[model samples]
Target: MGKFNRQLVNEIKKEKEQESAQLKLREKYEVPEDVMIVEKDNMIKFSVRIIATLIKITIGIIIFLLTVVGIVSLVFPETRNELIFQLSNTLMQLKKFLNI
Candidate 1:
């Protein structure tokens, strides 16, 4: 065969390989015939899972910070007194607001 013919054959082979790869990827991602697919429900479920994960992470961080603060307060009498005073002030403010 001529050089041009050989080059054409190689190009066709490369194109075929690329097409097969794309087809495999499509097949892998395609939903099965027996399965039901609802995009709206799937989106909502994914969002709810993400929000729940974030809420769990935030709660974990808050608990860790509270634990550290409690330990520090136990080791420092001044901090414990300040914490108590600040808590009382906050409660009093809330009490006034609730009375209104």
Candidate 2:
């Protein structure tokens, strides 16, 4: 065959190869035209879980502190009055510092 004929044949073969590759890719990863795929919103789910966990931890800490205070007040009734007086004085000092 002539040089021009050989070049044309090669070009046609290359185009056909490219077309077949495209078809294979389309077949492998085909999405239906009418169907819609909704992806899972993992970020929202993760945020909700994190917030819930933090709330649970905070509640647990508050409960623990309250239990400790109750035990201490029960064990040391006399000291409780002193503790309250000190806390009130500390709060006053803090208020003065903040000028609030």
Candidate 3:
């Protein structure tokens, strides 16, 4: 597996070198400054997509947890009562701290 990984890395490096050489050869045909802008745009777009996906996943997890809590509250009366008591106590503490 290590040998295969090394071979893959070497192949990728060689490909990148060849691509760079070609880009250099074609530098006169296009603006070099625009290349950087285009790369930055692609990076920003990719980053936004990743962030959106992460946000969606986080929301899904939160919803799943809420559903679990809801089911637990429905199934266990004692646990639901305990949780409500603890939540009220926490809220009261917060309210007192805020002098509200």
Instruction: Residues 1-100, candidate 2: write the lDDT tens digits.
Output: 5457888899999989866666665666685444433435698898998999999999999999999987897689797887888889999999999999
State the lDDT of candidate 3 residue by residue for 1-100, as single tens digits: 3456888899999989877765775684575543532233588889999999999999999999999998998689998898899989999999999999
Q: Candidate 3 — which residues are off by over 4 angstroms?
A: 1-41
User: Residue pairs in steric clash, candidate 3?
Assistant: none
- Runs in model 2 deviating more than 4 A are 1-41, 80-100
Tens-digit lDDT track of model 1 for 11-45? 99998986666666556779554443333458888
TM-scores for the candidates: 0.45, 0.40, 0.51
Comparing 2 and 3 on TM-score, the stronger one: 3
Error of 1 at 35 (Å): 12
RMSD of 1: 12.8
Ranking by lDDT: 1, 3, 2
Question: lDDT (CA) for every model shown?
Answer: 0.82, 0.81, 0.82
Model 1 lowest lDDT segment of ten: 31-40
- Highest TM-score scorer: 3
TM-score for candidate 2, residues paired by index: 0.40
